[model samples]
Target: MALLDELAAREAAMRWLDERTQLGTQTVTQPDVANFPFNGQTVALLLRQQGICKPRQLDAALSIRTTWTPPGGKPPYEDVEGPDGLVRYAYRGTDPDFPDNRALRRAFEHQLPLVWFVAVAQGVYLAQYPVYVVGDEPENLRVALALGNQQRWLGVPGPDEVDRRRTVERLTKLRLHQPVFRAQVLGAYERSCAMCRLKHVELLDAAHIIPDGKERGTPIVPNGLSLCSIHHRAFDANVLGVRPDYKIAVRRDILEEIDGPMLKHGLQAMDGVSLTLPKQRAQHPDRERVKERYEEFLAVG
Candidate 1:
């Protein structure tokens, strides 16, 4: 009878998941799960025992909690993935109500991906992953309650095996490269877009002077340029080119074409302008790398 009852309960939980998942749209954490995924290890343990340990948190996005508090709750620390691909989420052990420690452990043990939400002035930002939990404990150097792991979001089914493999590979590469690259490049550029000086970090992207897969292409800052999203796209698509001398050049065909406000001002108008550079000479884009990429651009043009 107890086994039957447990089976019935499991069926109920599965039913809840089915009812909550939107059939047409992407899967997100249902309100109940997202609102308070885990309050502490006890809550997390209870959820896991009840067969509710895993619910997709939208895209499994990861986020760093900021100093800004939400209306009622304090924020969690930003999780950091190290150069070796190990992720560490630190927490102060003082708060018993802080459920992240247990939650992280459960996710690791079960091999489930978890979503991290960070509170900010505007709203919450999130990071998610199928991280392989390496266990949680205290560290001496930067000692705190830490949950460490490597991100490996590969288990979920995709359109097919090839697509799944490709997606996972790309995600792994970005996990290893993007954050460090962005941080170094943005710091050098003082967090502004190099092309148009757009100041928002969210609007900025670190673009490679030499494309990432090329012979000399690397993730170092000297080979990076912080550009706004639009300009990054333009730079990548060959609509905009940066010369060895750091001048901006629009493709001749794009400059010659008549277009609307976006093209007229955003792209063509910026032609022949010198790039806004980092104040620190050491952080400046390497001219040799720029020359190599420019040669490619000229060849395409």
Candidate 2:
């Protein structure tokens, strides 16, 4: 193998080792454009495992451009053919000697400074591949790779920034809908609970306005209510609802029962209370859905 190819192989090996070690498993095959999707963090993990801990090494790796194409037909761009007649792709700069080659290289030489960009972008693209069957667009792949890389690097928040990056990456894959829902609800509720005025993030739950299993579609902002756990469970179980006018309501019987004082003191006090309007009014729950849910709650008891 050439020097750059040797480096790339070593980097790939190191990454596999790192993953194996971290996972407490034996050595496995390296991640690549084929078996395991390649990204910046994967490259970085490999480099770090191999003791190439300098940013310069990362920069060099990021500068490489690997070949990617559809299963059949010519690539959208030109590629340089090797002795074996297969097009060779490098992660580094385009082969300066073959200026006329149709091979399109994903630009990374100037964009490497945005650390983890490769991994994040590639990871997202890879994740969507099964669903969307993303095609090989060099530029889009570059962006996806970079984004996936950066996201992976920022996995989790901790003493080690790398760990934090990794955590974020994993979370991104697992709960893709969470951030969108949280942003929408928080924006709608002005970052406070509509019921308890709970502004602290740790104390809040993005309670689904309509339960997930109840024909409510996804847990989007329009289908969500910002509530503390107490209120969230109550809302889910039909103990609470929001009127079409955005006023809170409690089940009448729950409020009137002889043993209702607890519900009254704890939840009934919220009845008729105006919603804590969101800063971005556009994010507020749809009145129609809320009204429908309210009607449903009324029928339950």
Candidate 2 residue-wise lDDT, 77-190, digit = tens: 343422221122322223432321111121222222211101111121111100110112334221123223334343224445555545554444343345435544654565
Clash number for candidate 2: 41
TM-score of each: 0.51, 0.47
lDDT of 1: 0.55
After TM-score superposition, what is the CA distance of residue 232 in candidate 2 from its true location, in Å?
A: 0.6
lDDT of 1 by residue, 1-301 (tens): 2334323333343333344432111123223333332222212111211112433321111222223343345544444544333444564354422444444444444443333322112232222222344444444111111121322433432445666545544555565346546665776787899989889877888899999989888877789999999999999998899988899999999988997999998999889888899876766898899999899889889
Stretches of candidate 2 off by over 4 Å are 1-57, 60-174, 213-216, 258-262
Candidate 1 ranges beyond 4 A from true positions: 1-170
Q: Distance (Å) between predicted and true CA of 281, model 2?
A: 2.5
